[model samples]
Target: MSLFFKIPFDKKQIELAIESLELQTSAELRVYIERKKKNQHFSAFEQGLDYFNQLEMFKTEAKNGVLIYIAYKDQQCAIIGDQGIHQYVTEQFWQQQNRLMIDYFKQKKYNEGLINIIANISKELARYFPYQENDKNELDNEVIIK
Candidate 1:
């Protein structure tokens, strides 16, 4: 019963988050970004939604790492991570947002509207999987349905 976390996000953030995961040395990982079929000509938002839905197909797996989702709404973007990495990543994301805001403020170009939008997106990304403790054997026995 390894805990499962779900992140609903948008594409650019998802790409950066994946890059951050790749920097981790202790985890074995695989990342799937939903690619829009070139011939279909879907809108960017539609393509992101398709990828997010595709992630649901892997919900049953109990691997010892994370999965991510990227989604969009109107002009906002989001990133969601699996339970294994949610807390750490979400915290890091907020920290990053603060840094960005500070940088903008320091330049005396503090755009309140832009900052609020970023904050809103970050808030949406902060959702996490409720923690659950599981035995080693139980984790090992878990299966991911494709």
Candidate 2:
């Protein structure tokens, strides 16, 4: 069983999110970032749609027994799998973003507003992958002589 999370945050935000995930107890975790070509002939909207289609393909490739999480500016979605990573992201992150938006609106800090939203999302992801105590003594002591 495997777990996957996809967040369509800004490039900087995504990098920060990945850095946080790297600190988890699970060292074999995999991460991928989707890139859009600038020379494409389509409009921004069309490019975004194409990117989503690629995401769907990635999800299918993830197969069964895998958990998936996705966070975009307009939407935040998650998929959970049994016997795999537990689901943790929820609506609260968005709620927090709303609150931050209000504050940013008052301060007129548009860039800060976006960064705040992504930071909150990253925090939520961090909470999902907490540190687990390692127990090496649970292994069997059986040995075979060849």
TM-scores of all candidate predictions against the true structure: 0.27, 0.34
> How many residue pairs clash per model?
9, 0
Report, for every candidate in turn, its global Cα lDDT versus the true structure: 0.35, 0.36
Residues 16-123, model 2: lDDT tens digits: 543444344221122222223332475433443344344342242112121222222322223332222324444454445555654664565534554454445444
| Candidate 2: stretches off by over 4 Å | 1-86, 102-106, 130-146
The alpha-carbon lDDT assigned to residue 102 of candidate 1 equals 43
Specify the poorest-scoring 10-residue window by lDDT in model 2: 137-146
User: Whole-model lDDT, candidate 2?
Assistant: 0.36
Work out how many backbone clashes candidate 1 has. Answer: 9
Where in model 1 is the C-alpha error above 4 Å? 1-21, 25-50, 56-73, 91-146
Model 1 C-alpha lDDT per residue in residues 67-145, reported as the tens digit of each score: 3221112122223334555445566663455455445445543334223434344334333322233312211112121
Task: Evaluate residue 21 in candidate 2 and report its C-alpha lDDT on the 0 to 100 scale.
Answer: 42
